[model samples]
Target: MTSTLSRAIVNYPNRFDPGVLSELPEHLQETIQRRNNVLGPGYTLIYKEPVEFVAGHGAHLVDRDGNDYLDAYNNVPCVGHAHPHVVEAVARQMAAVNTNTRYVQESLVDYAERLLATFPEELSKISLACSGSEANDLAVRVARYHTGGEGIIVTRWAYHGITREVASFSPHLGTGSPLGPNVRLIDPPDPRLAAPGSTLAEHMRKQVRDAIDDLERHGYRLAALVTDCAYTSDGIFTDPVGYMHGVVEEVHGAGGVYIADEVQSGFARLGDSMWGFSRHGVLPDIVTMGKPMGNGLPLSGVVFRPEVSDEFGRNVRYFNTFGGSSIPVAAGAAVLDVFEMENVQQRVLENGTALRAGLEEITKDSAYVAEVRGSGLYVGVEIVKDRATLEPDRARTEDVINDLRDRRILINGTGQSANVLKIRPPLAFTSDDVTRFLETFAEVAKDRL
Candidate 1:
């Protein structure tokens, strides 16, 4: 009963119903009751009610009680939820061929080649996976095998995936989580380290150099320096183009691979570039992606320089049952088609500039807002306890989230202390939406701050 209501919450693809759905049947009422009993009488009871959602289309979600909401959280609805072209493509493919990896199918090969063309010419090979985690997990295995190394270096708060080995790469585990051996932690780039008159790119390069040097001195063979291009977890970023070059080169100097985790940062979310790594102006040996591809269908892959996989193939074998399934490939293809036809990236680029301007204007008077960082559609409003202390302000951040919900704007918080309001709406999100969000958000934030 509780899981049913939880599914009701999870399955809602758009704006959630603002009010407690009083029209629910007795069975759904019991489901909501059990949900409250298990999950406790918290936000869901008051601000967010447990309402069964029926369906979605474009940027709106309708519940069993029939309420509409402007979606700001879903990127997988790239061409808008239940896009007709995408739906038709999936239906056609489902009717034609939904085969496994064992077959030499056109859908798999065509989609693979199409995806590869999106990357640099040097990226010659691609491997299929079902999710971002699977892609990262596979990259880890390949990198370790290719470099013949044991140590892996990653960001302190980065999220790679849910699988066992990749979980070791994520330091968000906190106090009691189990972890793998040889995973080294590092702080995300602090502006203080580089300072004024110092180049951020060079600073990042120097830091990676120090990390590799320290690892070698400690008798650890470094295999890879894996990170999401955006530094999503650190809540901060090193600036300027090619900020990652020195680091990637340093990893190579230590005979390690440089893997770009593009699951969250790719598909033109950055606005200025097709891939997040493109903004860095450096090529990654391996690039993995998911979340937006297949327009919410479980389809993802790793694009790598062909030689990396060839070297690793000597020791390991990999295969996924549904990585490039017929339906998923069709969905992915439809996404590509929509991107080209709609020119969504161009709109995102323009909208991103507008969004940043609005947000900067929104938080100008708030002392709690430490910094606003990120580009394109992904923006992070960093919150601190005080300017002097720079401590995490989790409680105040929670209150602001509640306030936003009260205004019916669906936004959430992320980063180390869960203080930064991580904002990345769908590509379909407009300037008007940005303005509305800013108005509501500023009003909500002013109260809490």
Candidate 2:
């Protein structure tokens, strides 16, 4: 059954409950109290029994008691936690010079050029930012300035970012963050939801058209259609490839740009492609990325067609104090270096295939596991009360997550119902880590499901 909890609450199924703080270890209890006092209630911890990690390397994290946990959730450390290359680059650059983009920095330009090379040739102009929210915010601004429209569209449960403009379209932020009057929401491109005798692409195109019509009815001209290519928050529907083509076509037909929010699905996370939008075979007018751009460093950027940004760039003076600073750029360059040196794309493809195969094998007999779907390393295991009805079992999903945590395997949930296990580990995750994760998950499923 679906959760009865307030939609305003962030959809984190494994969120820690403060009422159980007394049951935790004495040290943890003290730590929690201090955190609440200092950090306030704005931040929420995960897991039924919160974990305090002291150190992390590659795909494993070491807790205060020296207990090791396999990391199968965090994607921020795309190349691995504390990777020496990124660490050394950031340190070296920080020691040398950490100036803003105002100063002419060769390394900064070099990093930008390298990053732009990964995208389609048309998306050559880039604007740097400190976070995904900032990148998406800039993207929206550019789209509105270029098209002179106020309307924006996104999936019903999409989580783009936290900036005021971006969050207004990011419905996954929950009911507490009201959507802007100019924003409209549509269902993710789920093939299962296609109507009888219709293809997924046709279904998505119709949805976009309907949203556009509604926006017009409300006196909002279409500015852009933004989406997280991975559909991470809408249950990770990454199948029936090339389905986004029709959706993009519909947006373009309405004189609106398509913004690919690749914060979670970019940088080879989806295995076969360097960016998630490439998998759909449709080029986005603007692309925003972050989370893993500088490994752990706060680096994000928006790359768009030069024509799309020309009006905005000429009229607006954009400057982020730390956006294209030398240190973060150096860290970003190092991340690119690792991708080339380690052949990260190929590794992700192989590892993702193996991981998905193992999970499918283990959960084949499970009544709770309705499906295992994703591209590359970004996977989602849908938990349902009944396989036939496909009713989301959020409570069972929470049990699976907490049980896996007890077994020292880290994972979280996503989707509108918060019933899909989000298995997105660092790109550095290896075959051995995959095996370990599957073995533990199998045991957890057997015991709990």
Candidate 3:
């Protein structure tokens, strides 16, 4: 059993190192040098070999050299890479006109109406932005203004975004990066990993209350509790559905808003539902979504309670230059249209169920495999050196990931120790993709672990 304390304090190790590019192909080596000179060291690449892809089509990516790798890791192109529907919509819109939000755009309101319909009635207003970081920044400002408070709560390993304001909410950036003085970190609920006799619901309530109390003790008013619904950066704990209800209640009781960061978990990524917060059976005061909204395009925003937005609108003059503009609007509308016409939610649900089953079966035959858990298409496979001790096998995890990459199967590791394989493919991933992934994964597990 995983202790709550251990889970909260777990350190996220650096998974990819640019130094490993020593044995890279000559072209990639030259590309890396160019990237270092132009893009700087801040940018990161995946895999030991560091692939340079040229094109992607429906759950598969073609590298610069024409090698096709099965993509089991990218969620930004939610529906599928270069999906004709989204492509056509964006191109058609751009060909006609692509302007700022100040213009009268029916597509903007149309997309907003379609998106707002997906949320609970309370989340009746929308404000668009260019990325998740911007949406989260807006959410924090709205929360602070509405509650007249400055404190924020987040999971110890949570990652909201990269902007200066949002980065303060992302503790996963590690110790060198200081969180805002008003920010507090809490442990997320994990049903599969909680220690014996410890109920996740009760533990979460206690932790939330303690966090809020700590905030007040520090002379800060409670502004909001922001959480990524899937807990993606906090190790993908999606089990024990409705576990978040208690936390939400605590936030409301404290007069603080609850902001659901659904950038990685929204758009039917979790299956059966279009949004991750829906899985917890609790509604947030404000919900932020991005990444897949425009299917690879730069588009993100927040949807909040009408009253909250109304109040903010009256006081603060808020306007994003390119947000909710022509191209993103058309692309977002086409994504919604594709979801309806293609029944993406139902398909993802079915595929996810099959994936979990396959992974669970595979775990039984592997010594390094400790657990296989997730909802919809976002899954995590825990790699451990000792199943009895639950000690993470980071070395083995890295080996498996690189080996899979070598075999033309793309995936990555996540969690504090980077020992849990993060498997989130495009929504269009089919049964064939699953078979290929499982077969390749099993081979790597056997050979490397």
Candidate 4:
């Protein structure tokens, strides 16, 4: 039987399928050739009609051919593409002074202070890194030191980062890759898997307990249970968010830490709260965030309890050359400023509510759409061959994605079968954008299905 978590994750294409790009325009063809020549191997573009974005503003992107596209697939530009506030802050800081953390930079300190304020008081210490991978790697180190354990637990198909150690914990990389000796895999808290009389919380607790037992049997003590709070890459699982409380307490009981990888769920992207962990009413011992942190600039970090870091600091020293440097720090600070100035979280709630309602109505009578669900701006439309059986339809999902691209709307499919359409738009996406997206989506669904 296919696990619920497996059904939720989209099977990312590893090899390029040339069939989709066969009829590209001459100009795009030439551009693709040039890119291939310069960019070595292992490159994959999103759509069959790959876009060479020349410029971006608000929630849209303009390709080299001057064709405009609604960019609903990018969250790195959470404040919208080329947001003036963040761009200006980065440029101004770069012009003034761009240096490492060794120097006394007031802006860096101020940004750290501002960012820390959003987190709970218990997470009093912060350490900046350049990407989600680095932050997570550091988090693993911190957990190991704090607990004197080598075991780590993650969801079966969880994706943490690209580093060697992190990759060992991310099984989604594939069967060819080997996992770390001390790492354990657990099924995500899928609501569908809950037994008739039990809750999702109970199912998840049992899963975590089983993982802990397995790790212990391997002669590895539990160090941490790292999870993507939104389960973004394992398929966006956001509902009855408080179900993970038992899992967290279980980690604590086993003397393991809970590390929340918020690369996809932080900074008001979830709409309901500032952090996804908060939505679940759980406080992580270590929280690592990236992607939207600097709003395009390279800035990610780990936020942890002061005492935890104190011990790590006493035993081992840590520093990153450009981790919390001047320019990225400035950009980070600007992101927070934009969040407040524009009232982003509340706006996300409004936009997400509208998008969800519209999607539910549009896909209600569809034969392929199994479910329409998600939180805030992050939405997923599950595509199935038969609504009654709920069997995934990857072929139809791929066709829908291409058709949406043809209509100038951007979205992608996710889940193990790549059957769920992911609709995570920028935080600044408006009511008008929502209507346009839904109209285009309905048109595409009608024509394709």
Candidate number achieving the greatest TM-score relative to the actual structure: 2
What's model 3's lDDT at 116?
Answer: 91
TM-score of each predicted structure versus truth: 0.87, 0.98, 0.95, 0.95
Off by over 4 Å in 2: 1-7
What C-alpha lDDT values do all the predictions have?
0.76, 0.91, 0.86, 0.85
Cα misplacement distance, residue 313 of candidate 2 (Å): 0.8
Model 4's alpha-carbon lDDT is 0.85
> Could you tell me which residue pairs clash in candidate 4?
8-415, 9-415, 9-416, 10-414, 10-415, 10-416
How accurate locally is residue 385 in candidate 3, as Cα lDDT from 0 to 100?
92
Q: Could you give the C-alpha RMSD of every candidate to the true structure, in order shown?
A: 5.4, 2.2, 4.0, 3.5
Worst 10 residues of 4 by lDDT: 1-10
Query: Model 2: C-alpha RMSD to truth?
Result: 2.2
What ranges in model 1 sit over 4 Å off? Answer: 1-29, 32-52, 193-199, 236-238
Q: Counting only residues 3 or more apart in sequence or on different chains, how many pairs clash (N, Cα, C under 3 Å) in candidate 2? A: 0
- Candidate 4 ranges with C-alpha deviation above 4 Å: 1-10, 13-16, 19-22
Candidate 2 lDDT tens digits, 131-230: 9999999999999999989999999899999988888999888777789999998989888888999998889999999999999999999999999999
lDDT string for model 4 (45-81, tens) is 7776776788999889998779889978889897989
- Tens digits of per-residue lDDT for model 1 on 1-449? 56644543432122235344566567776776676578743134322333355777765666666776556556677767888889999999988879887887887788888888889999989888889999999998998888889788887777788788887887664433344567777667656558678777677777777777777787879999998887776674524566677888888889999999988888898888878889878888899998888888998889889888886766667878899778888999999888898898997899878877888888877778888777888887777888667787866766776677656565566676777776777777777777778788778876887
Ordered list by lDDT, greatest first: 2, 3, 4, 1
